[model samples]
Target chain A: MNYKASQMSQSKKPDADASRSKKIRQKRIGDQLRRLYDDVTNEPVPDEFLSLLEQADKSSKQK
Target chain B: MDDQAFKTELAELIPHLRAFARSLCGNATAADDLAQEAMLKAWKARASYQAGTNLKAWTFTILRNLFYSEKRRSWRRQQLDPEVAEATLVSNDNPSSAIELLSLRNALDELPEDQREALILVGAGGLSYEETAEICGCAIGTIKSRVSRARKAITEILESKMSGLTGNDSLSAADAFEDIMRQADELSRDLPADA
Candidate 1:
């Protein structure tokens, strides 16, 4: 009976630890994805993007 | 909105569109081309946009639709060079890239297109579930489930890359965290600094 009780207690710790680590894992994934995304967002808007729009506007003026 | 006002707002959204495009396509050059196309489309379609609604979401929907349509067209073309395409896929799986955290890009690339977009829209793009559903043209519940599954899948992929990863994945998951950190350092140092 005592062995069974001790085994249950030992198993319970893993469950707690697993949940804790899962949260940590999720936090890391979110952080990394946000960082990856933010890096691109922070980059200077390439010159072509604005140039393309300016060209489109110029052509539309002809119509 | 007037023509100038519409153009100004669309310009401001270009950086975000590029960011979102990069997440969708993983290749910077292709993603930039996609973003430019979407920006042009949004500009041309400005008459249809409601003045006070969520313009960001509207632009994102345009970008997402363009991406999927282009992806479909590319898939049709790729039948001509299946081997070449598969070779590219195999090379991407190679971890020899010297770029910081290429593994995360690879891991994100491995997700199914739907799940990857859903996760990026919600997880990275900071959209509400309702906004994501509208952008995806799906129900809110579907978006929630896709986001949850994507989170689980990313965790497994990132952990596998961090560990030396034998075939058995469960063992790695159940292993201690310190081992993975040590492996990460070792893997990072293997490539030459300049490479």
Candidate 2:
């Protein structure tokens, strides 16, 4: 019984390895996309827009 | 900006920025502020934005700049007190899963800011080493070392935390990390294409 159990566990290792490898690949892809998303939203309004807004605000203040 | 143009950009990037901000700031308040600041900066810099270049990468550069430049980081460091550490995983719904995730987040939070940023950018955020180097304003080797050390520290903490919590030692700690990798993979599959 002990020998059989050991063999069963040994055989299972490959299955586990294959599954884990797949996960690593998926994580890599997911991580890339996540960074892409972060970059996009990180800057909501570019500096140009902010300058324009500042100018408008100043003009209104003068008015 | 025209309604259509603003809508298009918002639709394309808001969710991602939210995720990135959440990871860095740990809660909605700071996350929103970080994202908002990044956006304001991006808008001001719009004229310099090259049309064919990656917009997302440019935006992250802006956000990271703001994060490092602000004096508020000192205050933010205090906010990361051990008292608030317990709250890290309370937001998780499942007890068992929450404990594991909370423990992980707490351990991550405990890391030095540079190490933490390195791990999040590469481990969770998924940037290539080159991209990470660009974002961090460091050499590629530095990025590699930082990420390696960050993972080692996290793994050590996770192993210790799990040891006392669960009586069963059926699988080793290495196995546990593999399991997490698998779950992350599954999450990738389940996530929306845009996500």
Identify the candidate with maximal lDDT.
1
DockQ of 2: 0.18
Find the 10 residues in a row with the least total lDDT in model 1 chain B. B73-82
> What is the C-alpha DockQ of each candidate?
0.43, 0.18
Model 2 / residue B106 / CA error / Å: 0.2
Clashing pairs in 1: none
Worst 10 residues of 2 chain B by lDDT: B74-83
| lDDT digits (tens) for residues A1-63 of candidate 1 | 699999998988888756656665676668667866876898899999999998888788788
Segments of candidate 1 deviating more than 4 angstroms:
A1-13, B72-100, B162-195
Please, what are the lDDT tens digits per residue for candidate 2 over residues A1-63? 699999998898898766665555444434443443353345454444345445544554486
Candidate 2: tens digits of C-alpha lDDT, residues B1-195: 443354356345555555566667765456657766676667556667776666666777787888778865632433344444455336435444434444556677778888888887777766778877888789999989998898777766655654543565676664466456545645565544432
Per-residue lDDT, model 1, residue B64, is 86
TM (B chain), model 2? 0.71
Best by the TM-score measure: 1
